[model samples]
Target: MRIALAQTEPLWEAKQENFRRAERFLKEAKEQQAELILFPEMSMTGFSMHPEKIGETEEEPETLNYFAKKAVEYGLYIGMGYVEYREPKSYNRYAIISPKGGVLTDYRKIHPFTFGTESVHYTGGDALGFCKIGDWTVSPFICYDLRFPEIFQLASPQVELIVVPANWPEDRVEHFKTLLKARAIENQCYIAGINRVGHARTSVYSGDSMIVDPLGRELAHGGREEELLVADLDLEMVWKYRAAFPAKIDRKPELYRKLADGMQI
Candidate 1:
């Protein structure tokens, strides 16, 4: 499948403006024959601590209905991240709008970045979910979750493609690239990382959006600017590399299961 990543500069705390920006990018991506397009974490409301400005998280579908229609119009899958205002709490989520104008998935971020007060405002996700679309099995994860390999490992063998929508900071640019490559290589799968650009009032994000192959090679990456990144994903390589490496089969599940039971490995 041909995937496109929008390295957009979100108007901090501006959901309407960001939604307009995403629509424009989706139109362009459709013209390029992209099957799926991805945007950064909280693409609609740029990452911010002000819950009042970002509380649209509750009525997520109200905002996503616009994109869902766009997906049907363009006949392409669109993945965008935003905040959901659920009762008593909000969530950091990525919504998948299918080509048929329906909600494919709502992936809430399991690892809420507690470094600041992110955890305080947002509720974390409990389970990871993957969906089958066309010839690809797409798994979703958020920003800080990239540091944990075990989660991706759990989704492994079943999913050949991983989508990471993040608002990664500029302070750790190297971490963004290296970890993406490592995840792609270790899992023998494709990794698409979409990050934002520009300095928000609270933080500056490194806009290094990239697509990595199963061999951990970068197919495309954006610099520190708003841009569109497209990369062709080869499904054959996912199987080819995994067949050669066979890491999934090497897992000591019995021992790992015991460890999860609080026993020594």
Candidate 2:
């Protein structure tokens, strides 16, 4: 499938401007003949703690329906981040919109950044999300979730591709790249990470969005500018690699369960 990652330089907590920027990017991605378009972390609101600022409905709200409708109109699948309302609280969420403008799934950010007020403003989702789009079984994750490999492992051999939407800091560019490659190599799946650019509230993001093949090779990467990282990948490659070097099959799940149950690593 042809995948496009829009590494956006977002407007700090400004909802409308962010949407305008994303709409332009989506149009360009569609023009490029992309089947699926991915956006950076919190593409709509610039990754902030002011949950009270975002509204519930589509009008004055963050207006996710706008993107949904655009997806249908353009006949493209879109995966973008926003703060979704959940009555008394809100959650950092990714909306995977189908080509027909329908919501395929809404994956909430399971791992909240405790260093910021993310823990204060949002609650975590109970389950890790995995879904099928066309022929690909894909998984979605947010920024800090990259540190935990088990979440991706839970998806197992089912997920052929994993997408991470991150607001990673500029100083830790190496760590961000390291984990992206590690996730692809260890999971034996294709990985596409979209990170934002520019500074927001004293935190400058390193915009190194990329697409990695099953062999842990980066096919496409973005710079510290608002741009689209595009690449074509084969879904069958995951099975091809793992079958030749069946490491996951050789895993000692029985003993590992004990280690995962809090025994020292």
Candidate 3:
């Protein structure tokens, strides 16, 4: 499958303008023959904690509908993040839409960035989202979830590709790159991380979007500029490598139960 990461600079609290930009990017991705396109976390409204201003309920998700229309028009799968409001609480969520304008998945972020006080603003998700896309088993995860390897390990057995939409700051870009490659190497699955560029409030993002193959080879990468990074992934390569090496099969889950027993340093 051919994937395109839309490394865009979302205007803070400006949904319409961002939606316009996203449409242009989607058109470009379609022209490039990309089957799927990914945008960064909080795609329309940069990374803002003020959910009251940007959050949308599932019943009235204009942002999601906008992308769904674009997906159908462009004949490509679209994945974008937003703040989801569900009754009394809100969650950091990513939604996937098919080419026919159907909603494929709505994945709430499992791990909120506590250091950034995201936990205070949004609730963490109770479940992971996984779906079969083409020849690959695909999973969608949010920004802070990349720091937790256990979640990746749990999905690794069934997932062939993992997509992360992040609003990571420029200061911690090295950690982002390191963790992305680590996840790909450990799980033997392709990983695509799409981050934003430009400034959001006081924080600045460099947009180090990248696509890594199952073997930890970077197929495509983006720098500080707002652009699209595209790469073609082969599902056969994932199965071939896993069948030959079989590293995940060697994991001793029972022996590692102590990891959940809260051992302290």
lDDT of 2 by residue, 181-211 (tens): 9999989999999999998998988798889
* Residues 8-93, model 1: lDDT tens digits: 99887777777777777888898898999998888787787665567664445556877888888889899988777765667888
**What TM-score, over all chains together, does every model reach?**
0.94, 0.93, 0.97
lDDT of candidate model 2 versus the reference: 0.84
Clashing pairs in 2: none
Clash pairs, model 3 backbone:
none
TM-score of model 3 vs. true structure: 0.97
Q: Which stretches of candidate 1 lie over 4 Å from their true place?
A: 57-60, 260-265
Question: Least accurate stretch of 10 residues (summed lDDT) in model 3?
Answer: 256-265
Error of 1 at 171 (Å): 0.5
Off by over 4 Å in 3: 262-265
lDDT of 2 at 57: 44
Q: Between which residue pairs do clashes occur in model 1?
A: 57-83, 57-84, 57-85, 58-84, 58-85
Residue 48 lDDT, candidate 3, scale 0-100: 88
